[model samples]
Target: MKANLIRLGVDIGGTFTDVVLEKNGSSFSTKVLTTYAAPENAIIQGMHQVCAKAEIEPGAIDQIIHGTTLATNALIERRGAKTALITTEGFRDVIEMRTESRFEQYDLNLNLPEPLLPRQMRFTVKGRVDANGNVLVEIDKSEVETVVDQIAEAGFESVAVGLIHSYLNPAHEQLVRDVLAKKLPDVNVSISSEVSPQMREYERFNTVVANAYIKPLMASYLGRLEDRLCEEGVRCRIFLMHSGGGIISIQNAADFPVRLVESGPAGGAVFAAHIAARHKLDKVLSFDMGGTTAKICLIKNQTPKTSRVFEVARTYRFKKGSGMPISIPVIDMVEIGAGGGSLAYVDTMRQIRVGPESAGSEPGPACYGRGGERPGVTDADLVLGKLDPKNFAGGSITLHGEKSKSALMAHVGQALEMDPVEAAFGVAEVVDENMANAARVHAVENGEDLSEYSMIAFGGAAPLHAGRLCEKLGIERLLVPPGAGVGSAIGFLRAPFSFEANRSVYMKLSDFDSQKVKTLLCDLKREAAGFVRTCDEFSEILSEFKVYMRYSGQGWEIPVELTEEQAMNPDAVAFQVRFEDDYTKLFGRPVAGMDVEITVWSVNATTPSEKVEPVAATDGADTLVVNGARQLYDPATAKFVDAQVVPRDEMEEGQRTAGPAVITEEETTIIVPASRNAIRQPDGCIDVVTKE
Candidate 1:
């Protein structure tokens, strides 16, 4: 760590922009509503607030690490620049066709997501590259010129070039980019080979298109943010958090904005991992609930699970293959629109249905007193006495209880023939069950049991329902760390400067090419390390290797970790043994006499994470006192009870508070349910456990 260095971390979410300033070891944080027109405005306001709290000037900041949902929102809302896709001849519809696998097999009326580029926007060139990196048909310059003319006439701001088998050879794609650049010098071009050098044309093509779609927007926003920060006298290097839970330079982020799709949620997972390391927990689930979405990630051995492919804007709530797939490294998690601002209403079945729709920052919830008339989860929370209307968001915005009641009664209560409080209970129950179902599905898909894992809750809205969620999931322990409301921002500070580079190269174990494998691994390491070097010049960059392996006829592959030495010196026997071991772990047993094939190889270059001292376990809890009391709804008893309300700042290590209680903080509040007790652990974490 640099001595006396001041680091600033900002996370722009759907509803709020969180800013955290760390000087020496102490930290100051603040949350402000996100400005949809210009996100940097919120960041600037939040920075000023945190700086004032820290009693420092903006110029004193040494570094700024940022994570945002802008790129994701742009793609989901279709607000990106006018973009076009160029692909190999006869393959223009690959993105729309989408592998022929239906997520809803029984439903004949299943609706697939539309491609990012329509048929008119997707153009094809006469060029071919074989799977073995052989050029079957050379590029035609005149044909490229014709496409370039059409693109120029269409006023496209960005173009995506994705030819068949371009992952193996980029010659054709490069030619198209070169020709297009020569003709349209200002347009941004993204090639599949450079953006996602992996197999599967549909995924690779869609990934590049997504990258191209958001490139101009992210680049302009980042440039504007840089200029504004400079005007505020903050002279420091800026980095962005990617979806893989690592930090990359602003230029790299701008170049491949698709990598930032889950950046904010990835930070929350990183924060949970850090807390897990401190507590020495091997299995933990990260629960992050912000204003617009709730994310659940499984953390094992103090590291969040990572995946190569991630889907965004899922049309079907919990079903896979119903969204736009982006083949980029990302922290694996399940996200649902079950947040504080998620709107709630009664459906035709006379049942309460919570969102996939959010009010966001413009109207926020009914309690925000904005123009929104629909009741949201936050409004329900306020009506249930789980949130204080006067002290919400640090008193920056006073919530209106009357507005919340009116909205709930009009939208949900009247339909269900219940009062506002009863309607609020129904809404809260539906949202909580929605989140719980998502978590359960995620765990079941991963073949894990929720009872064995501890839950780490963060983000602004997580604590308010974490205890109840744990009760629903049969989870015994829950940890809410310090700065839980701005956890993602703090995670931006803790993340390492790193990057992962991967490529697809098929090789069977029986016909292992040692030299070729070594070469591929070496190239991947160099590529990953090169990006990391841009962020940290002197820190040691550690390399981690993984290969995707599966049976010869399997559709998908499983990741098998490889040591640096194993990757450098390929041993067929050792590789097979590791593959079988991992395969057995996932499927209970490996297939006998079946040849194993490797499809993709990956190398992650990262700086070593900061070390954390483990917290010593305690045997007995100390006595506690009730600071105050408030009427809180108890779902189990279906009534309101006077619960102890305590300020978080006043609690010390080893202090204990019995449930039904509410632990209040400036950023958020933790509601200890009637069945659980809250204890302040040694590491400044509130440990909520079921009462015996």
Candidate 2:
């Protein structure tokens, strides 16, 4: 008999490698410092530890799902392969021209992010397809051979082909790809029609170029990971999380690597959604703070809000329009560099500024004793008495407090003429405020109010600073779920095997074609379902439809939900009614008599969500005793206070602990601030509520 079937989830973060093992009804997890050279080494080590504790062999694992920050890191570090872009002749300037909007309007020395491929690397071919899906200029086959020779001589590892209006007519793009394969079989190629089938030349070109830039890197890493896993006696299918909050097969992920840019953060959002569903919560703000960056995602009614386009590597201090736009389905969220390992420094303005630069796993933080001299947010937390130097990561790695103090005092303390402790508090507070402000801006931009949403804090550092952030945002309640350290990994297990299929099919509601729309929707359903079938063998599949619509002459589109029956029988009146309803809900009102047109259509097919019923309340202690007390700086009091420390496992269900407490777990710590109350929930979560 099989020893015991288990499902494993692994997340490789910038600071730590987290693994969660689910066998039968129980779960076990382990956290280890991430190895930068080979992230898979940390995963294998953590897996071995967790399985050993559970007394199971590696072969007993039935499935292993993984999420990683590698793709995002490659984009941020500019470590991807040398890439070339082939676009329509005149459209080579589109990526640099952008939308003619400035992210920073007043700065005279504003520096936009440099395009991934320079003008010389961005070549154009003799081909033109009009917006109406008509061939304006036939692609010159002879010209293609010359372009191929130039690209080959340029030593580009990959190439992106994006012709004018290729989303409407992909014939020329396909022919170019075929010729390139014939000329250079080893060169990775991506086309806009296949990578991002949408309007807007800049976004489509950026997406395809980004895909090409990362193709070689992702392909090599994925192949090595698969081989290593099989060598470790794990014979199971591997799936990767997509930015759309779904799991796709490795093949698909490799082909469209841009979709994997936000894949890890998307998993964290899914994990928070699952926890919200378990507690019957309708609105939640998922906060994930890892080592390299912090992300905030909003979930309402058990679904994370999805966006069709997102940016990568924001250059102007995380401002919109300062980054490359990639058209893909992704969970909408705001990501900033305020994570534990985010470096801090005093800028030219003599003001403290936290990162967009991080030490990552290689040097990590000064406290980790990894030869990092610059202070990080983690070292500051230690100096502020927020973290137990000896108890971090369940004592797997002991932090050097003196080193942390030295780094802080040498870098920030001396400049401000303040002691290390005060500087630490200042750093912590500033970073906390930065994250809170980002959360507020993101929510307001999406027309949401923080007071109406509960906060779900996860990741290694999120639980540490969540209470303070909640207070700053005026958020009343926060939930710290179990397995919070590897929340994204747990989310990978929760994600369903699904795929989103999108195509550019322009249609005006005023002159809608019901039969044509019906046929298109049917074809999309089959396309999406076929992709999902490759990952899951289940006989049942469910699908959802969406249409990207905009007013006539508008250059952008917003997503509108469509039911299966509605897609099959798209009546103009009914379509307008649904469109206006959604429009009014978002923008308060719709322009009457304005013609609406659908620019793109999308379909998502997936397995059903898993059922996780709420746990019933049980008789338990009302108050829990503390293990010890420590001096914690209370910002409200402007002084240090004696805070109680309690081990999370020792707290019984329904146990209540007042504010000024530190609940420690093996993976992370939960800090309940002075103005809040913490309660132990039935399902091993710490619920924090504001004081009346």
Candidate 3:
């Protein structure tokens, strides 16, 4: 790595675009409202602002790393290109007919999420590939040409080819793509074997469809962004943050745009993991709240948990199987539309409910004075005196307290028959409880105890509510690191160039093929390494291996990590022992009579991570020096209190202040409740702990 290299990291959230410029070991950041029509406009705006703050020209920057929620938003809003899916004849409805499991088993009126492409848009051809990669029926060129002609007639911009058992054999899908390309050369194509290349036809098919769905949009956006940046005199390499918590070349990103889903939240998870490493915390709960969403991730041993498959735009909040599952490597987390812009309203039961819906940047929260009529969390925060009208977002956008009050009164107060302040309290309480409940559910699902973890809060809105969330979750320690407002953007700078490759080739313990396993792992390693090489050929690369294993009759598999030696010299007995150990830890015991089987194998290749030196724990000395005092709402007391307000940069290391205080910064504010005390750690992190 080059020392003192200037790099720019930009993250586009639902409501805000965060930009961080790191040059000469110093960091400068800025946040701007996201431009929905032209997302790159916001990036360029933020980039120029941060570049000015860093006292450097855009041309001086060495590299640009970006992450965005555009792909995810496009899927949720159904705003992508007119895409079609071409699959095996009999499996045309596989994506619609999901697995047998129901997210809400007892609800008679449960609504399953609709498939991305409608039935009319999905076309099929006559071809068959068996589970073992054997071709039962060769793909017919005439059939593929006919399907291509139909797709062209339908005006499809992109097509997804997902043949039955394509993960095992790609010949049939490749033939279809070849014919499609020959017949309709302008349309984009995505094949399941190349996109996912894993078992489970539904997930693989959906993954390819998603990739094709967003391919044209993302490709155009990236092209425009590059052109815009070049016009702004930025001449450097551009990389994209991927869902797997790594950086990939922009070309790679455009090709497999589905990998970029959840990229922004993945960066936040990476940020929390970095902080965890710095603090030497073994267990951490990462809480990131921005304008449009909140993400909760569990970090163990300084590494965020990863998943091979994660759902997007979940229709049923907190329900696992109620969303479209995209089988891609991703940083695991629970995301909810519970952010500053999350609209608050009263349900039929007269109970206040916070989002899944947000008044995004165009017409943001009522307090933003952006023509939003509905009451949102930001409006509530403003009404509750938790936000400074003149200081929010460095005063780039002024907030209107009166508007917030009126919105709250009209939306929530009237229904609940309460004053605006009381209604604001209700909105705030409901949103906070929603986040707390999400955190609890996530922790429980991971078999983790929240009490054993420290909370690392970031994003534009996390600090404002993290203390209250911590109090609710019974978490003792909270760390609000510097540049918390642009944490995800900064995280993009810290991410390594990496990629993960996975394939499914089943092997039972009784008939284990050591040579085949070795060959598979080697191939995966090479594939992953090839991707990393595109990003940085000179950087030393490292490989990590894992296998998804299960008992003979079980459907799902648990991931078991493996060493290079263990993977190369596969021993059935050793593999079973390791699987048993992990299964026992997860379920308390493993079945003794069942034989173990390996289903999917994975390899991750990456450049070296940035080294983080641990910060020594300090006993902060109490020194009450208040810069000012503000009338802040105390949730604990259910009333307003005169709380000391201090600028974050003004406090020295080891300085401590009691709760009922607000620590202000240019980007965000940290609210310390009356029951907790805030201290300045040596690393400039605001460490808040419960008062003894």
Model 1 C-alpha lDDT per residue in residues 74-187, reported as the tens digit of each score:
999999999999999999899999999999889989888899989999999897888888999998999999999999999999999999998899888888999988999999
lDDT of 2 by residue, 75-187 (tens): 87788999999888988888888888889999989887888878888988887888888998899988998999999998999999999899889999999999899999999
Off by over 4 Å in 3: none
- What's the candidate order when arranged by decreasing TM-score? 1, 3, 2
Task: Please give the CA lDDT of all the candidate structures.
Answer: 0.94, 0.88, 0.92
Of candidate 2, the 10-residue stretch with the lowest lDDT total is 615-624
Error of 1 at 498 (Å): 0.6
How accurate locally is residue 234 in candidate 2, as Cα lDDT from 0 to 100? 85
Task: Tell me the deviation in Å of residue 477 in model 3.
Answer: 0.4
Estimate the TM-score of every prediction: 0.99, 0.97, 0.99
**Clashing residue pairs, backbone N/CA/C < 3 A, model 3:** none
Residue 326 lDDT, candidate 3, scale 0-100: 95
